[model samples]
Target: MGGSLPRSVDDLPLLPDLVAPQAWSADLVAASDGLFERGVRVLRDGEGGLLVIGDAVMRALAQDPAVGGTPVEFLTGRAGDRVRRATGAAPPSGAAAFDAFLRNQVFTMNAALHVAVRRVVARHLVPRAVLGMAGHAERVLVGVLDEVTRVGGVVDLERDVAGPYVTRFWTDQLGVPAGAALRVQQLVHEMNRMFLFAPTLEDRARVLAATEEYLELVGRTVAMAWERGDNALLGHLARGLDGIDLPGAPPDLGALVAANFFDGFHTVAVAVANAARCLLADAPAAERVRRAPSLVAAAFTEGARLTAPLMLTTRMALGDVEHAGLRIPAGTPITMAWIAANRDPEAYDEPGGYRLDRPPRLGTTFGGGARICPGRGATRMLGEVALRALTATSVQVRLESPQPGWVPGSAIRRHPAIPVVVRRVAAA
Candidate 1:
């Protein structure tokens, strides 16, 4: 966990007791401004920790020649050397390995997206005849809805469903044994638990166990593809997993699974829920999206911009850097405040307003540069599917309670539970 700082100087006077005393220091405030000016990827002070802000800097670190094309590692307390080795160095590059990794990643991401879209379309849109697809979309939606209802109200949206869905889809695409898919699902669940839920030492151990199991499966799948001289499979896996260094890490499986989960499920799910909340709060916005299915993506993007799930990203200064006429010394910790940056008055017109048709403003939701999220396209597609389903259905969403709020201490903004009453509309 990291210390908290006020969103801006104006909020400094309201620092709560939970905020780290050091977070209110003058040097940190100056560094925050300097980070905005330099457009550097990372900013740090004397402490060597970092706040990663600028897209330019983020891109540079991702493509840094010094690391052989690896993103700069953000060093944390007592973990500098370990973190450096894990993220600061690049993977062994050979044509064969790199190609395979890339291909595998594409296949996995596409497969995951496919499942997500299908889930939404079948469950929400098809039944309502919103997209006019033939066949029994209603049956499919009913099956899932019935199952969910039977299972009770408590659903682990990320773990019990989305994680398993992606893992199964990915494994099937890669021709891996079906049994191993469960291990992947467990890995995904544990990682989400660790990073996004009640993070604890025991939770971490579960993550490690799941990771080991997944790696064994991935390793076997990779070897089998190679032995069969399957060029396509080899190339995909190589490219997808290329440059990932996991030496001395708790468990390679856990980290990789975690990465995939983060890329695929976490962001998209949160975005979907949050976007729905936004629409429900503003009737005009909801009507705009409902009237035009083509505008779903735009609406989602606007919602994301307004309430960026991630609050901040971190980076450490590798050396002294000058930004906006201020000098930031080597080893400083820099925090890139995404929530603030997305709302910057200079960057966004009517910063607080959510207008779907507005021109795209370059923002850091999926990050930028070499480390920019590779699964961004797929995630967007997933969001589109969810929106399409929700809008197509004639279910009226009424706020049973006050508008939902976000949970703190998370790297991303998340809605714990959105209690809304869904009443099916009478047939027109």
Candidate 2:
């Protein structure tokens, strides 16, 4: 279909209109497959930008310096801002701070800024540091599991277990006072909605409100840590930010906190839910994990490969690049369909199978290349802890329905309700 770049983006094949809405509510994987069957490795997305499918192209795009992390709007356009203004969703108070927070986030930065922020975040989130938190993560998960089993009935895994477990883990990890954990979780949850694929004015308004409060909360938390000399992750972050230089002036402490904590929580929570769902569905795998708890890590990795937490991520082209016999011009926005890439037949054998023996990072779930997710280590560590504790528990989970119910239109893949019946197994 491609000889040279299309004369215009409109000249390319268009993605189905329903892909975005259905992506979160239904099967994003199916939509990805449909694109492949039509031989649409690269297509024009009606919403905006060029949509890229297939493993090779997606990986090449992700790794290319010309294809970057900043959203196209920030790079070249502001359509969403125009729409928000037209809808009378005036800029919220602290809009400057909000914008700064987004710009400072590892996801939105590019070039020098991206490198600087990633370096700082990496120091704190390295695999060794994340692994050190394993004991605490295990305790949090075990407590949550015990509470869930004590209730003893049908449970929504996402709502009842994964959500609270993550909330508690992050709250503890961040050195949040026990009393404030719930509020911190609420603020992070609200802030996370801003990551949705396309938010209405109402959604933006809600996000603005939550982000404002969340920033204030971070300020107070940092202040308290300084006052008390709290020796937790938040304190480490606070100490770490001292005198750090960036492209612009250094980002506010709150921006750094939000960048590290909120982003990690979103993907990790989804990974936990997806991993748990996969384990519950695969009896032989679950049994093997149960027999050798060490296999829990592999099980978590396989689960993430099957259903990535983030279905897709968009990048703006810094310069023209050629891929698949097509010339993508500079400033063109490109959407990398990670869900499709993870399951690409060319990338994995029996892509649908729950095989733990596969090589590491075979999937695009956490993305790849220069912008591979910085929180990937932490995500896996947390997922492994949750799964290990689940296997060790005297509890059993079976799907109440054969299929899961997913949250609608979210940029992040999430299960709103994985209804499961729980039975406590008598200990041997």
CA RMSD per model (angstroms): 10.9, 3.3
Residue 248 lDDT in candidate 1? 23
List candidate 2 segments past 4 Å from native: 1-11, 17-26, 71-97, 421-426
Point out the worst 10-residue segment of candidate 2 by lDDT.
71-80
Residue 383 error for model 1, in Å? 0.8
TM-score between model 2 and native: 0.88
Q: Model 2, 377: alpha-carbon shift in Å? A: 0.7
All candidates: TM-score: 0.59, 0.88
Residue 150 in model 2: lDDT: 87
lDDT of 1 at 231: 44
Task: Give candidate 1's total backbone clashes.
Answer: 32
Residue 203 local lDDT, model 2: 67
